[model samples]
Target: MAYLNKLRLFIRKPFSGLCDFNRATTAQCRKPLPIWLRRDIPPAGKIKRVKGILAELNLQTVCVSARCPNLPECFSKGTATFMIMGDSCTRACKFCAIKKGKPAPLRADEPQAVAQAAQRLGLSHVVITSVTRDDLPLGGAEHFAKTIRAVQNQLPHATIEVLTPDFQGNLDAIKTVIQAKPDVFNHNVETVPRLYPSVRPGANYARSLAVLSYTKDFAEKAGKRIIIKSGLMLGLGERRKEVLSVMRDLRSVGCDVLTIGQYLAPSPNHHPIVNFVEPEEFEQYHQEGLKMGFLAVASGPIGVKLRQHCHCYGQTAP
Candidate 1:
């Protein structure tokens, strides 16, 4: 949404060089996906104080908003990727279940709340994410930085991973967040390049790459190699070659961690699944990625592949 709005608003914009708006809507590949796909995944343990901490802190999470299937598993382990800002998103990607519309203002207390949640959960690794805040000045990058800083202030020793949006290609805005010094900078590339317009309609591949590239480049320049990570959803009609190409692109940008999960549509309104990536296949890709020299690779059915990798690598956060 921001991309389109900016494209229409400014004749020549920075990201305009990255995506072609005219060629965005041409893909229409279709394939029959398996029917018995939707299943409730159960976690192995209980996060003792999770709900109370969330209620007390007034924080929201992609785990709940996007109905991430890994919620129980992740939460039960006393770890969470706290979704900062709020529940509403600025854009409506067809593949996402997060509510779409003009989102509300940033909750002034959220940063402290997330930090509190981390402290209460004894979270050695805290993952913070947000809905695309295209409506904000600085695209909410300042808020992201604040949250990371707050969490650090509380935990002081916990590793932090932020799953952020492309800050409308404003390198200055991205710089602000990077300067906050997160343990890992993660921005999901989401899908294959070809289906972006129809699947993640509001985002861009090159822009996504640019975001990762900028984060990695800056982290390196800062004399601290913060782990740079990203994820992909399979079963969206993406090809094997395309997946490998994405891996290569990530590698080229110095991304150290990657997650490849089988896409599971939340509802019929969202994009239908084209297929299910089996666990075996996910393992194949995981090993391939290891061979490719990725420091960590998570690939599997229901996103079980990288579930523990982030914990291990992230726990080492300084």
Candidate 2:
């Protein structure tokens, strides 16, 4: 019966002006954003400067591709997480705003282009992520290695963090990226296990966890001290206990860092927000995560605001 109800909700058309997916839309399923979730508009001048640099380099950022609400603020602050592979993603995750289709052929110059952009931005901490490129052999692990090396060559003092895909649980692929020696290796599980089929149909929760576990073991074996990080989105109909269970699972796998944030529905066509998790709830989760042994926990509306929030309270190897 519950399954049938979900099926009905999927088929139903969203109501009125609040329903448009292509343009700005409102939360059709939940109430308006709370005061804490509301953010200030970024400075126009700073935004333009960042955009100009990204455009010149022909680079993609998860900030723009995922329609992150924090884009203006991140860009205005002169930091952007470079999306390396391409703009198109192979997996059609219901909650993502990135277009899903045949991604363009891997640009051989991307490594250098990304390095150039980082140089132009004068970034001291560079975060690199990519669309899930399942079409590529080794799940684009080699490309990730190349990009990491390129960034290191350009900015020897800067810290490099990578938010990567699961590589279909291929240990060899995981090893390839770990060997690149990024300061932090991150892979988001996205949501609780029960919501995986509906929210992330193309991904497997166990496979994602395995990828983190193997990366941790591989890094330790190589005598490398790399931070293992993961993120989760709330307001996806997940119960409090379920959220804690996910945190425990992450800690079990030796994940050093965790990020929890509100899951804003990118469009009306995307997964509907089940509830707006309160600021207090996020704080509660943060406290619980620390107790569960995460070296650092970033939670709340701007939780995984990656570059800024991630480095706070975590021990990074020098």
TM-score of 2: 0.87
lDDT of 2 by residue, 17-130 (tens): 001111112343245877776666878898899999999889998887777766666677787889989999999988888899999999999999999999999987788999
Question: lDDT of model 1 at residue 98?
Answer: 82
Q: Candidate 1: misplaced stretches above 4 Å?
A: 1-48, 303-318
Q: Write the per-residue lDDT of candidate 1 for residues 266-317, one digit (tens) a residue.
A: 6666787777677678777877787676766766555242434322322321
Q: Judged by TM-score, which candidate is best?
A: 2
CA lDDT of each candidate? Answer: 0.70, 0.77
Q: Write down the RMSD of all candidates, one decimal each.
A: 10.7, 10.7
